[model samples]
Target: MSTFLLEIGTEELPADFARLALPQLEQLVRRDLTEQRLSHGVVTTTSTPRRIALLVEGLPAAAADLEEERKGPPAGQAFKDGVPTPAAIGFAKRCGIAPEALELRDTPKGPFVFARVLERGRPTAAVLAEHIPQWIGALQGRRFMRWGEGESRFSRPVRWLVALLDATVISVTLQGSDPEVRAGNTSRGHRLLAESVTIPSAGAYAESLAAVGVQVDRAGRAAAIRSAVLEAAAALGARPDLPDDLFDELTDLVEAPLLIEGSVAEQSLGLPPEVLSTVMRAHQRYVPLYRSGAASDPLALDAKDALLPRFLCIGNGLPAASDTVRRGNERVLKARLADAEFFVQADRAVPSIDRRDQLARVTFAEGLGSLLDRVERIEWLTDVLLEQLQLGAATGDHARRAAHLCKHDLVSQMVGEFPELQGIIGGKYLLAEGEPRAVALAVLEHYLPRGAGDDLPSSDAGAVVALAERLELLLSIYAKGERPSGSSDPYALRRAGNGLLQILWERGWSLDLQALLRRATAHWSQLLPHFSVQAPALATELAEFLRQRLVSLLEEQGVDGDLVQAVAGEGVAIERVLSDPADARQRADLLAALRASGELAGVQAVVTRAARLAEKGSLDAARLSPAGVVDAALFEKPSEAAMLQVLEQLQPIAAGEGAARYGELARALAASRDTLAAFFDGDQSVMVMADEPAVRTNRLNLLGVLRNQASVLADFSRIAG
Candidate 1:
């Protein structure tokens, strides 16, 4: 057994790329190793701003030796009158055996000639040489770069590579070049802290790197980052308020993490903290610290203490003094914050609502008019939502106001400077101006759940506004033919689509989806004169996106893909679906259960027919039989009577309980078992098809009852038992 080490080193990769590329490299390596049949042990991979490395420990030196048996033509058919046919001779040759050495085996298709192959193990180095390079080529990124006259491209240039098996080098070539690269008993430490270091063995990969200022394992790097940040904060009499997401990213950007504190200028403090931080992090990746509270007010200390201002800059090595880094970072922060403060003051000079109207002049898309037009669509959509959700006059009016004001922040200087804080800034500004609570809250919440696992809008007004925003974005993008294809969601319509579903499902409103779409189309048609797109195509594409959104939502809920296909077979009415995630779950569960029942599985088709007859036969149950008896005279046989009796018992409960139709059918089947057995045992078709019209009609009527019972549960015809 031996260990393997591989690293792809390049000129300092993008900080963002380091975080994403390392895990991908590790995953690709494991996949290749598994595909090669080289049984091994745990593989640890790491990445820094410059390199991706993988080490497979306790791996087998070669693939396992094995015997494989392949069956051939049947023994009897394989031979021609015992003289042996070409098939038998061919099988013998393929197996590297003589005809006499061939074996006979019984197979489902009678006897067959079998061949046993004893395969030899191949060297692990040979396996790696074939698979590693190919796997590396499969890495994914938003973009890749080709370098140095080599046809091969990656997220960045491939400067150097190390691939070693224990003490031996496993040479592999990729792209258009094969350089003198070797996997060795050596690796470089933090580029600034230490030069290349040698490892005595495979197991020493981690310790060797760490000894020279590198945390080779990602987890180790992340932990060191956290500890250093916390320690730096404590020393400054404050605690770090690192954004969880930003923290995760920083962890990935460094190998030997060194957290150093920096300060913001007192003059820059007037700029909104979010604006200042965004400018600092967006360009510098610096963690912004707030002012610490004094201990005199214990609770205040606890709260403001956490808000203390300090800069946590993860660097390659420890700096000489805090004053140097602090002064340098503060200089950059002051310049950026000054620009933001100017943008804010310039923006505030204009009235918020008047500025909002100017969004119409700002193109949201190439020909989609301005943000003002989108706001108009949202206003209309919000009104539709109010009616659809049946909100009263007060809530409806409040929601409309919220939708109208939601994008006001888009024109704000603060929002422009910190785009991520768009909604938050709007909400804050609205509150500052003493706006209604609903309107302020909606402005803040309208962009909720910006990503998967993000929090949803909590208030009714926010919910309405969020839905309007998403629907408008979807319509505008889809109308412009910028739809998502495969993994390329350039417009992020999928996320918007998924977000719309989350809102609808969480709200659980029974909406007339088709009617609303028709309304949306009509509204857009009137508004199209204000834009430059082909209105009809845009409307159609928008409708299609909504339809797909419904299908994805249902499919995600574990609805049978086929059932989703069938129901969406008609089209998804998001309102109807949202009225009940539970209903979809129940229907899917019932259909799935019915499918498993061999006897009741044909219910879909049977029920479809019964429903057709019920519609035509016009069986009126408006009045009960005063006599409390089903006409036994109408029953043609004991089976018919027994099935009728069970139907009579189950019908009321089925209709009243609203339990799934499948449960009723299951009960009907259970109750009528003896009757069905007797019917099948007897002449089931005795009166089923007869010269006597009366007898035939009665028998069909009995079949109708059985069919109707199952139809309510599921369309048995659709079920394939």
Candidate 2:
């Protein structure tokens, strides 16, 4: 067993880039090792602002030998009457084996000649030396750079390489315009705290680096940071606002973290808590502090008192000089907060109404009209959805108002400088203007769930407006041939689609998606006749797109693939899918449970037998019987009469709303399975396609009637066993 280490030293990397790319680097090394037939165990990666290190343990010195089959020409061509021909001889020579060493093997293409070859695996050190450079080059992230005009792109400039197999160094040339740096045992420590240090062996890598103030282990660094913050906050009788994402980023930003307390300006406290936190955490990478004199949860900041005007930051060096770094950061943050205040004050100089007109100058897309034009589309679409949901005028008024107000902040100064604060800033501005609280909050809630796992809109009006806006965006962009394809979703239409479906699922409103899409297309056609030139063609495309997104969402929720397919099968209305995703899911769950419980075997048999006959037997009669009518007078079997009576009873119940109703319909269908079986299985069984013309037509009409009635609920034929 051997301990392998790879250290890529580079210039300071962004915390996010290092944190995201380090895991991929570790995986790439593991994959390369596995592909070379090298077995390893406990591969782990750690990173700081300056370097990423992959330390693997329990790795064998060499890969195990492999036996492989090398197939050659067919038997007919390889030999002539049991004698080796030139073809066979040449193939055996190429395989580095004598002709007799080859064996006859039977293949799909008839008899073929095969050769058995033993391949001795190379040493692990030799393989790592060859692939180390390739693995490093393969590391990528959202932002990568090629320093010194070289094609060797990385998160930052590569300054040193440390690749070792056991006690010996494995050399590799980065093979680009990069300086000819060779892998060695030498490794550097904290850029500010410690100088260069030499790692004697792979086992001593962590201990030697720790001597120089570099905490190479990510878990150790995070723990140190947390302990420092908690101890510091304890002195002030407050809790540190240390969320996981911020904590990770802070830990990655420094090799030697030292916690320091800084003061938030008194004037900045007058600003909104969002603004305060944004300035402290987002702009300065500092954690906010809260005041707590009582015995509240030490880890929690929420209490009856206001948040204290203080913040804590993790410095990259020893605490002795951290005061200077803290003051510098505080000065920089004060300037940013001052700028935010200025932008907010300037935005208020002009009334929100006046700012809305400026949106006409801001283009939504190249061909699509300005932002104001989109507002009109969203307003119209939102009102239509409200009406579809059967909501009264009061809700419609709130949704429309929210739609109009939502994008107004896009043109505001505060949001222009801080794009992430778009919706929240708009809500704050509306509240300050004395708008209704519902209208104000709806402006914010429409952008709820900005990402996966985020909250859905809390209010019904907000959900409606959110759906309308996303639907309009999808239809308008897809109309312009800008549909998301092959992951090139420039318009983020997929996220828009996701948000729309999420709102529907959360609100549980059964708005007709197919109808809404068609309506949106129509609205675009009238509003932008030139832009929506092919508006009529977009409805079906957009519906299928939304269906795929919904499928992805449902599958991601751990629903059975076959059950999801079954519930979303033929005649599964798109309106029901988008309006009541939960109900559709419930139907799938109910059917899946019944199928697994063996409660629907008889029902399945009846549906399979009847639907199969319904297709071939009832063709001409079904074409004539659009209403699927069967004359009672023509019924010869009592079983047929009894089934028709039961079908009539199940009609209104199956057609009723809710998943419970669908479950009841399934039970009723299962209950009638015996009578349906008797109709087809017994001695008095009537031929659906009888020789008598009237009997054939009447029986075919009867099967068609049953099928047509079942069509209202689901296409049982598409259901999977």
Candidate 3:
């Protein structure tokens, strides 16, 4: 066994591209190694901004030999009465064997000529050399470019290549590179701290690079950075705001981790913590330090109190240069914060209401009118949702006020400078202007759950406005005939739909989505006639789109696929699902609970059996009661009467709403297992399909009623046994 290493060095790559390329390179190497029959152990992939490296340990010196049977033309065509033909000669030549070496083999299709060929494996170094260029070419990332009259494309210009097997330099070349990169033992180190270093072997690559100020192990660099940040924050009695995304980017931004502490201007600390943090983290990639015990909650009303007038920058330079790096970062942050303060002062001079009027100049989308028009639509939808939700008059007033001012920040100087501060700045401005706290918070919370796993609005008013805003986006964009298909949701319509359902589920609000959509669609048809399709057709398309999103959301929440299908699948009526998503969510949960508790087996067995037999009857699924449909007088056995008794007990529970009712219905079905079994197979059992037409019809109706009641929970047949 031997170690193999391949490194692709380039001009400083984007942090995100370096992080993304590591896994791609690892996977490519693993797949190719497996295909080549070169078994290996512990494949490691790591990256710095300057290079991506792959190392494989315990690799076999050569791939295993392979023997395969090659099928050829049919025996009759290959050989004519014991004499070899042209087809036989050609087939053997292609197989690299003489015609006499071919043998006749019986196959399913017919007798065919076959050649058993054994291929000798090549040295592992040769295989790696051949695949090195292909692996580099197969890498994918955003904004890859060509450089210096070369046709090659990479995240950055390819400057050098390193390929080795044990201590031997493996021969490899990157085609089309202007510099004509080839494998060698020499590898470059930190741009500022060291020059090129000679690698002794594949196993010594990390040690060699580290000796020259380059940390080649990505995990080691990340761990050192995180530990240093936390320790530095601890020494200052502060907490570092190192989100995972920022941490990963920081790890890739530097080859050697060095923490440089920078100071924030006390005057700049007066800005909202969100603004300060955004400037430090998003713009400058510095980690903000907050007071130890100060709340880090994004929604905290007093979040500004937690922020400290300091930050930590991950510097790639040596410790001797720490003071210079810190001063540079502090100067940069000071200018950014000063610009933010200016934008805030300029924005707050005019009231939020004036900003609302300014929205008329900003187009929301083509053919959808201006931002002001969108605000008006949102206000109208808010009222509609408030009416449907019936959260009370005070909540209604707050929501309407919030909806009116939601887009006011879009035209604000502050938001113009920091697009992410849209709602945060608008709400802060409103609060400063003496608007009611409820109204201000609602404005802020309306953009809750900007993505999956994010927070949802805690206030009723915020929830209402949020729902209305998402609804308007879906309706208008869908009215323009745009739908999210596959990975092409440029408008993020799927996310909007998911957000709507998530808010409803989180708040436990029960609003009829189907009725709300139809109303919104009809209203859109009137308000924007140029983009209109028939209201009913558009409403249906929107509902199905949301339904698909709901299904995905439920499945992601760990609901069984069959149970999700039971409530929102194609088998379930769309009206039933959109009528109250909360109810459908509850039904799916109840079904999963029953399955987990070991009760679904019994209920499913009885319900599925009845459903299969119920197919023969013409009874309506809506008819839960056997009162008029079944003739108790036609019963031929005691089991039949007993089964009817159980059905009668389940009618009220099956006809009711919510999880409690469904749970009761499942219990009742499980309890009736014996009576159903007796009716199907016991001494008192009677044939469901009797010779007499009336008796058969009556028996089938009894089963049909049971099937209908069970379906109130789910289609049991869809469940796996």
Candidate 4:
């Protein structure tokens, strides 16, 4: 066994590309090795800004030999009375075996001639050489470009390549380049430190790079950066706000980590902490420090008590030039902060209401009216939701006010410069202008949960406005006749649908979503008659979209897929799902709990059996009672009457709504397992397919009623036993 190493050195690559390419490279190497019959152990990949490296340990010098069975023509054609024929000789020659070596083998399609062929293994170096070029060409990333006269595309220009089997250099060459790159045993070091570094062996790659001031191990570099930031923050009595995304980018931005502490301008501290932090983190890639015990919730911390006038940044320059780097970064940050301060000052000169009027100049979408028009629609939807929810007048007023002012900041100078601060700046401006705190917070949180695993609105007013905002986007965009097909959701309609369901599920609100969509679509049809929007069809489309989103959200919350299907699958009516998303979520949860408690199998068995038989009878799925459909007079067995008794007991529970009733329905089904079994089998059981047509219909109706009652909880046929 020997170690193998391959390093592709390039000009500084994009941080995101470098982070994403490591896994791709590792997977490619593993797949190629397996395909070549080369067994390897512990393949690993790492990357820095300048290079991506792969190392494999415990690799064989050559791939294992393969034995294959080659089949030829039928036995009768290959041989004549145990004498070699021309066909048998030709087949043996093709398989590189003598005619005597071929043996008769019996197959399903009659006997055939077979030969056992052993193929020679290729050298590991040769295999690596064959696959190395393909691997480099297979890598993918955004904005890939070709340098100079080269036709090959990469995230950046390829400058050097390194490939070694133990201490021997593997012969490989990369084509399609103005300056063709070839594999060697030497790799470049840090840009600011040592130049070229020689790898004496594959096992010494990391040590060799480290000696030249390059930390080739990405995890090690990340650990060093994290420790430095935490220690610096601890010494200064502060906490570092190092988001995972920022931390990962920092790790990939350097070959050697050097932490530099810089001071924020005292004047910049007067701005909102979010403004300062966003500027440092998003714009400059610096980690902001917050004062200790600033606030219990870091997200809600105020400017005065939270932000410290200091930040820490990671650099790849020489340690002796730390002060120079610090001063340069501080100067750049100061200039950006000054620009932000100017924008804020100008924005404050105009009242938020004036900004609201400016929205008329901005189009939300083609044929969808202006931003102000959308705001009006949102306000109207807010009122509708408030009435449906029966929220108090105070909350309704706050939500309406927030909805009106939500888009005002889109035209503000501050938001124009920092597009991410749209809602944050608007809320601060509103609070400064003496608006109610509830209204301010609602405006800020209306865009909560920007994506998956993000925060949701915590306040009632915020929740209500958020729902209205997302609902309007979904309705208007969908009515425009563009749907999110495949991977293309240009208007983020899917996100809006997901957000709507997420808010409803989180708040435990029971508003009928189907009714809301109908009313909103009708209002849109009236507001923009030229668009030719069909109210009912559009409402139905939006409801189905939300139903899909609800199923996805339920499964994401750890509910089993089958359980999710049982509650909200295609078989379940879309009206029931959109009537109350929270109810569907609870049903899924109840089913999952039943499965975990070992009671679901019994209920599923009984319900599924009845549901299958119920299809033979013309009974409505919504019918829960057997009062008129099931004829007790047609019964000939005691089991039939016992099954009818269980259905009667389940009628009221199945007819009800909410989690408690669903639980009761599940328990009733579980208890009826034995009774249902007796009706289907054993003594006192009536044949469901009796010769008497009336008796058969009556028996099927009894099963159909039971099936209908279970349908109230789920479409049991869709559930997996």
| Better candidate by lDDT, 1 or 4 | 4
Backbone clash tally (model 1): 20
TM-score of each: 0.73, 0.86, 0.96, 0.93
Q: After superposing candidate 1, which stretches have Cα over 4 Å from the reference?
A: 16-37, 59-140, 147-152, 170-186, 227-244, 261-313, 319-323, 478-482, 529-548, 554-633, 636-721
When sorted by TM-score, best at the front, the candidate numbers are: 3, 4, 2, 1
lDDT of 2 at 257: 85
Tens-place lDDT digits, model 2, residues 1-721: 9999999998888888877777788888878888888888899888888888999898887888888889999999999999989999999999889998889989888999999988899888888899888888787787777778667788788999999887889977787746756789998987765678999999899998999999889889999999989998888888777878899889889888888888877877666666667667777789988666534321121222456878899988776788888889889888998998898889878777777889999999978889988888888888788778977777778877888887888999988888877777787778778777777778888887787888898877888888878887887888777767796988888899888887877776776787777767876777767764555577878877888887777778776676676667434666556555666766766767787888866777777677778776535422313235667777888887876777687777755776568778788888887777777878757778888887777777667766755554456777666
Listed per candidate, the RMSD to the true structure in angstroms reads 7.5, 4.6, 2.0, 2.8
Model 4 lDDT tens row, 426-496 = 88899888899899989998988688888999889999999999998998888788899999999888888
Error of 1 at 203 (Å): 2.8
Off by over 4 Å in 3: 71-85, 99-114, 295-304
Range of the 10 consecutive residues with the lowest summed lDDT in candidate 4: 295-304
Please, what are the lDDT tens digits per residue for candidate 3 over residues 100-159? 999998989999999999899989988998899999999999999999988999999988
For candidate 3, list the clashing residue pairs, or say none: none
Off by over 4 Å in 4: 73-116, 296-302, 528-531, 630-641, 672-678, 681-684, 688-697
For candidate 4, the lDDT comes to 0.90
Instruction: Kindly provide the TM-score of model 1 when superposed on the true structure, using C-alpha atoms.
Output: 0.73
CA lDDT, every prediction?
A: 0.67, 0.78, 0.90, 0.90
